[model samples]
Target: MGLQNITGLFYPSQTLGGPHIDIEDIITSQNVISRVMHSYLGILVPLGLLAGVICVAILIRNKVKHQTLENLDLHLLALVATDITIVFYSFTSKTRPDYLEVSNLSCGVLSWFFNTSYFFSQYLLVLMILILLILDDSKTSQSHLRYVFLTLTLSIVMSVVNVSLLGTYDNLHNITYCQLDPLNARPEYDFTKFFAGFCVPSLVLLIFVILIIIRAREVEMSEKLQAHGVVLCHVPIMFICRLFYNIMLIRRTGLKINAFYMSPREELVLNIAELAVFSGSCIGLIITLALHKPCRQGLKKSLQFLINKCRGKETSNSVI
Candidate 1:
């Protein structure tokens, strides 16, 4: 079969046999998906870069100053790094208007990298919170190292399975981005992706969150500390965002809507869900910055140092 004919099988029932949409019309019309992705990248790319750079600098300074590295510190660094990687990958995957369309192999490769990075970030958050729930006396470097190792291993496996079986790696036509074929994909595969991508991670996080809550009450940490833990961990917030996004996907695929059949209004809602998925990754870093004092102070000093150096250079230039 021709490549175009083979590609046709990936769309939902509504679009396949229904009214045809001109490829040019799809691209040039008021495309909400493209706009949404553009806006998401515009905000998230810069934010992730700043947070990742500052966090890395903070981790480096701690090592240089011979400060003890806590488990939370290590987790924050990993999360920041993952968030930045996803942002850059997203930028690379965004559709270019004039560039020749990408080949299926290239699309699959992009999809694999993007999905794996995203899953790693989510699963890492679950692992971090689980570690936090462990008794402080029992937690140690060797143990934390093991947990990190296992999390990455599992995330890589799941990403590969989802990309390979759950759906074919193909560009979503409207967004022109590589993703598991969403509309025409098998419901079984959609369920697989949903269960693995969001459901499992969210479940693990919720269990740990509950344990933390129980421990907070048992320890009688001040109400302030309990509230602080909830805020800093930010598991509930992340879970909610993922839950909403997963629901939207389930509904769309469950209802078997054609990929191209979304009205502008439905497309807007889908765009929001896509944004939620991206935003979910950013929350962990934001919480780390907000709650981790060493990280916050280090980032502040790092920024100020850069600012001062710039001023020094400008002053010397003026004098000369």
Candidate 2:
């Protein structure tokens, strides 16, 4: 197959089929799918970015005013920042009209950024759970900072490996397609990403959550424990949001290996899964604002302050 043919197969709207398929019907379906995908991205990406920025601002303000920030707060800030980057990158690259013309360097860098940010966010949650498990007396801000640094460093290394293996340049076609490399070329990369990035962290999170719940039942729940409860709520939300994306990845890999064509229906499902992944980040921020009293209070105060300032300006103008 030519490069164009191969690239076409990767897209949902350009699947190969038997002669029985109607060409006009396929064109109509493709147009519909494109509209749906664009519409979804238009709404979700902006809303997600806005919510992420607000959440970050609220967290930082609370930290500044109180002069006492917990380790969980620090991790939450990092996660929000990471998610913002992910959303922004997704919006720019996926929505671009000529993504196929991306230069080799740009492709590698974008892949690296996406993988590193995503992996860092996932493992940061694991560390947050671990911090919750540790005793209050033993915890220190410096230690938590070190953990954050360590997780970032590890994520960078893993992303380097991912880019080296999966991201490739096509000299003949004079184009670089990010994440378009054949999975069978280096099957280990996909397996490693799936296991290290998703499966292992998921397993660890499950065990820690169960242990935390058992401990909560055994002892009297304090304010600190209540914060831990928020983490518990976050765990399930993250899992559900990420689950579909992972499934889509697995399915895509399977279809590629078997040389099977992807139907429009399957492609629609994958597109929805992609949206779910970004939406997960937004939902996580909402959960923190709703369940964490400090953040919720901080947001309320900020809104009230803005409202009062606007009202003051209006009154002064009316008097003039």
Candidate 3:
């Protein structure tokens, strides 16, 4: 019903009162964390956007030349699109200057877009793994588009539910933040999101990764299977990048409900977690380009093409 009621449900002992901490201490810690977060985002967001554009260009060129895309390529393209969307949204939303006003409506909209893209990407990876495991190339190539549509539909629904539980507000210090809106901050929603969004999906992904590994061991790995293996790398990367951020969310929820003072150390950890979350896409893209053979081949071909074109221009200028 409200913050007071939600706090009572989880932290009954602290309901009476929380220990007093100096307001200046809290503000100082917040400011330090904010600077660190902004610095990390400043580096990561632009790098991610640039990498995403290059990857998309490569994929699009391949599609045009071949007149068709493989199932793996389609999935990778979708994943790249979502990752770029997440990075672009972060640039627009999280990196805003402190002096700018952020209305609650804008905050909610940004949060919704970020969460939608993130969840969509995660589930798309899951579907990619499933298709690799269960479907033959012929079947998957024919049906991947339909499956993508289905995953997008599901992601939209899940994101709507996720955003419904959150609301944005400005603190006494005029700092804008998004959190579980007082009216919707129930223990049920908190626990549900923790488990459903993080714990359960993570566990499921782990299981899928294990099964794929086992299957790979059972037979000779072909080029197709090797492509799947490259995609499989994303599962562990996702887990590592997201684990800290989810922990930070759980801790923040507890502190908010109990009205507990967040120490500078905790604030530092929270900023680090936020950094890890944003880094996931960047790291994933790097891994894809480094290990995915087709991407490597594409890069080499593009480089060679550029070199020849530049050489041709030089020859013509010399003749002139």
Evaluated with lDDT, which candidate comes out highest? 2
Compose the digit string of candidate 1's lDDT tens values, residues 1-320. Answer: 12332223322212322354444444443365567667766876667566667777888789678755666666666777887676566454355221224455565556677777778878888876655566442567667767777888888898778667634444333232234333334566567778988888888877877777677765544443443463346566567776877887786664553433444344346546756766766655566666677877877887799999999999999999
lDDT of 2 by residue, 194-267 (tens): 77788999999999877776777555445458656667777887888888778877787777667776665665
Q: What is the TM-score of each candidate against the true structure?
A: 0.76, 0.84, 0.80
TM-score of 1: 0.76
Regions of model 1 farther than 4 Å from truth? 1-31, 96-100, 167-177, 180-184, 220-232, 255-264, 304-320
lDDT of each: 0.62, 0.68, 0.66
Q: After superposition, how far is residue 268 of candidate 3 from its true place, in Å?
A: 3.0
Task: By TM-score, rank the candidates, best first.
Answer: 2, 3, 1
Steric clash pairs (candidate 2):
none
Q: Give the distance in Å from residue 19's predicted Cα in candidate 2 to where it truly belongs.
A: 4.8
Report the lDDT tens digits of candidate 3 across residue range 214-241: 7776554444476676688888888888
Best by TM-score: 2
